[model samples]
Target: MRSIAFLSADFLANPWPEYARFRAERPVWWADEIRMFCVFRHKDIRTCLTSTDYTVEYPFRVSRQVFGETLLDLDGPRHQRLRRPLAGLLLGQRDNIGFRAAAEDRARTAVAALRPDTELDMVRGPARTVPLTATATFLGIPPERHDWLLHTVEYLVSHLDGSSGDFARASALRAELEEYLLRLISTGAPARSMLGEVHSWVRDGRITAAEAVGLATLTLAAGFETSTGLISNALHCLARHPGHAAGAASDTGRLRSFLKETLRWEPPQHDTVRFARRDTTLAGVPVPAGSALKLVLASGNRDAEVFDHAEEFRPDRSTHGSLTFGHGSHSCLGTHIALDVAEAFIGALLARFPGLRAVDDPMPPITGSTFRRPQALRMWLGPKGES
Candidate 1:
């Protein structure tokens, strides 16, 4: 027994190996330092994620050091009530087709702008640009404000490691965002777009001003980052497995399988945290109420018991679904939209640049947070036959 942290680098860089080891020995082990039960097996993870006894601690007292107490931290009825209007905005079928198509168009335009033989930063290019542009455009935010919004999201995400200065900065940004929303609400901005619709929700009391800002900020913060990561990670996976990419590029069936397998292989949110709502037992291990449990979603996705040759990225492989987006009532609201954007981006990229290859200099640095992603990914592009 090593008696060290379970899912540290030994796991993040190549989790399947560690998960196989842990799931075989201590599927449910308590981290004394973190004061929570760490579960690595697929079945145990699924049980914890889907269980009502566990709850998302809002404003994540710990994560508030970075993300603040937003909807991501809320739970139960309050979380549901707060999420209703936003859910309506994201899930409503009213104009979803138009919006979805518009998003794809925006992605296509971004892809078309790529210059030949250039090392494009996926984070700054299509990954960050497409979603931010599409979401901001949909919300009717002024084109000029996109830069400031992206900067804000970048600064906020940087503060995730409990930096005091970062929190102070995020606090200021949060206030500025709230004030901005309040003024928009006070002036009764004409309902010009979805962002305006969010203000309308506030004005009509469907959501509070704070809630509205949180929703908006969350949209800005989470929307682009995760959506971009999904495409980038999927591409990285395919590039590593040329056969899988080729398979998916030719067949929609293969594409669907690729999506599932990619998610299982490298989910955006590598781990999800929870502060137990009350004393609870997870698969027989006792977790004290309020203890922070790190459910290794990425680790769980590759559990050998649930997924054969879990370490391998095989698009055609069949098995239970991954908990990438999450499970239970508090699952991601924008998951479908995220999937849509990802599929569109990958679909377009493969169709346009079948010879896409990763750049030696721009391979993104693997991160060490609950969310697993490269800091940036740059790829070499060439004519169809060049690579």
Candidate 2:
């Protein structure tokens, strides 16, 4: 392993320029700070993602603490078994009319509550509420428990980012969340919900009760946070390019492309880690067993070899796909649900507030190293008559 200096704080705040440099100079290099081999190029990252030699079993200390042993930390048949039932339910939910309509209704209601001609924090308004509501509704979380669920999810996500100062509080919250889920399962409330489905799997001896808790925790936390980031990031992108927002408002195809471009340009979760199970060569660099590879999905999305004008956010740009939601076995199961959430929220926002514009001149800073999104999107809602 080749050791190098730690990445600077500024690079973590805004990493694209640094990523460009790495792509040009050393696309694959070892950083001592994180103790992981960082892969920058698209092809190499894709290769690492699909390769059987690399597994997602790298020690994600915070995730393990908060979520227990989830599918994210498993590999081989064990991972497949845990993922199968949940994946089937999620895939089926994607095409369910009731689920989609409920999501749209939630998005519409959230956006409609914002008064025109007033500045609003998009994060606090639609971005945060829509996904939380949608996920809870789909998971069959009771209305009374929605507030608790949201708060717990936020707390869990903070720990998942691995930078939270209050680990003790996060640990307490994780315990509380687990207990709450166990009770919810026992009560048999929302018996037809995903949690109920998971409980059924447990009864059938497919997985343990603890595994069910973990899967439920994973669904509640992962489902909401990433979806929240996607909505917030997409809004930030649209605010920066008003013309695209206008085009997207009237054209469904353009709106879909706009969301795709946002995913490519500023993916919510920046990178994911994988552990080398055996000796391997990545981009011709020798990787030893038990080494961690930080697959920079954000960098791969902007690789010059794969994308033209890689730095610019052009909604109309043609593309095959981006690594935003990852690839292969560990690809996001909620990809379709996330896209649906974005479509519903963006469509509702554009319809309700025709001339939405960013209130901050430069806009709020996008933050986080492991996870990235606008801290808060302050936007001015144009008068009802304005277009």
Candidate 3:
């Protein structure tokens, strides 16, 4: 079997084949170039994520310098203390009927604005707009401030995959965003929003003012890019299999199954890095303390032993709860909201344009090593009045 380099551009473009080979031969191997142990199989990846020995703290110098110490860097009680309030808000928002209604309305408005028989980059149009609008709504920001929120979130996400020069600009943007959040908090909360809840936390002295800013930053950044990527990916899947679009619009159950399969087949966040808190063994391979381990989540989603005919994208296939959003203590807090936003946007798109289909053969390829999605998804919206 050929040795796999995780950082190779070729692997980034199409990693499934290489991941298959690795899962078959070497499920766990150390890559000298990157200096991180790569964990590939589904079972092992689950263990790596849930095991008490590993941590999500930044092991690399660059990430630590860039992101600073946020919730991702904490462990034990501190991690729970920081995470609980935010998790409560997110869960409440997801369960709130008012929030869901507003999200669906925004999604419909976004879809209705699109013109038919014209080439449209779905990523920029509905895919991007819907999530931004929903996030702004979640924060209780007025329409006038939506642009600022969008730009701030976009700048922060760009830095996640930025160069050295970009880091300086990103740092400036981070400061500005934190200040903006602080200002928003000063004005008082909107009666029915997450920002309001966070503001109350700050006032009660439960969380410091600085922690409030950090929590807001994490909420916006986490919800923005991942939600956008999931929407774009789901739409791309529907376009590839145009036959499914109609069923998705008419049947809620079928639509959900399609979305779940999409999550397993092409998750937005591909891989996550973790550090060994102490000298430990993973899959019987000894890893020294402070060493970095790259958990290939996309690879785990395709582990043949877990899913029957995993390589193929079958909407009806049973995923058995894939590790796309992760598991255990560090699992994503926004999983329910993310799925809701994606469902609303995709459902609106299908209902609005039942005959939607890809404009180009093979379409655009999904990219990015850390967060993955189509670079551009161009599709035709059938005729003017056919919907």
lDDT of 1 at 36: 64
TM-score of each: 0.88, 0.93, 0.94
lDDT over C-alpha atoms for residue 120 of model 2: 86
Best by lDDT: 2
Clashing pairs in 1: 58-73, 59-69, 139-195
Against the true structure, what is every candidate's RMSD? 3.0, 2.4, 2.1
Question: Mind sharing the TM-score for model 3?
Answer: 0.94
lDDT of 1 by residue, 64-86 (tens): 54545678777778888888767
Query: What do the candidate models score in CA lDDT, each in turn?
Result: 0.71, 0.82, 0.80
For candidate 2, the C-alpha RMSD (Å) to the true structure equals: 2.4
- In candidate 3, which residue pairs get closer than 3 Å at backbone N, Cα or C atoms, i.e. clash? none
- Give lDDT tens digits, candidate 3, residues 130-212: 88888778877778888887876786677665343577777887788778788777675586777777777888888888888
- Give the clash count for model 2: 0
Model 3 ranges with Cα > 4 A deviation: 59-64, 93-97, 162-165, 384-387
Q: Rank order by TM-score, top first?
A: 3, 2, 1
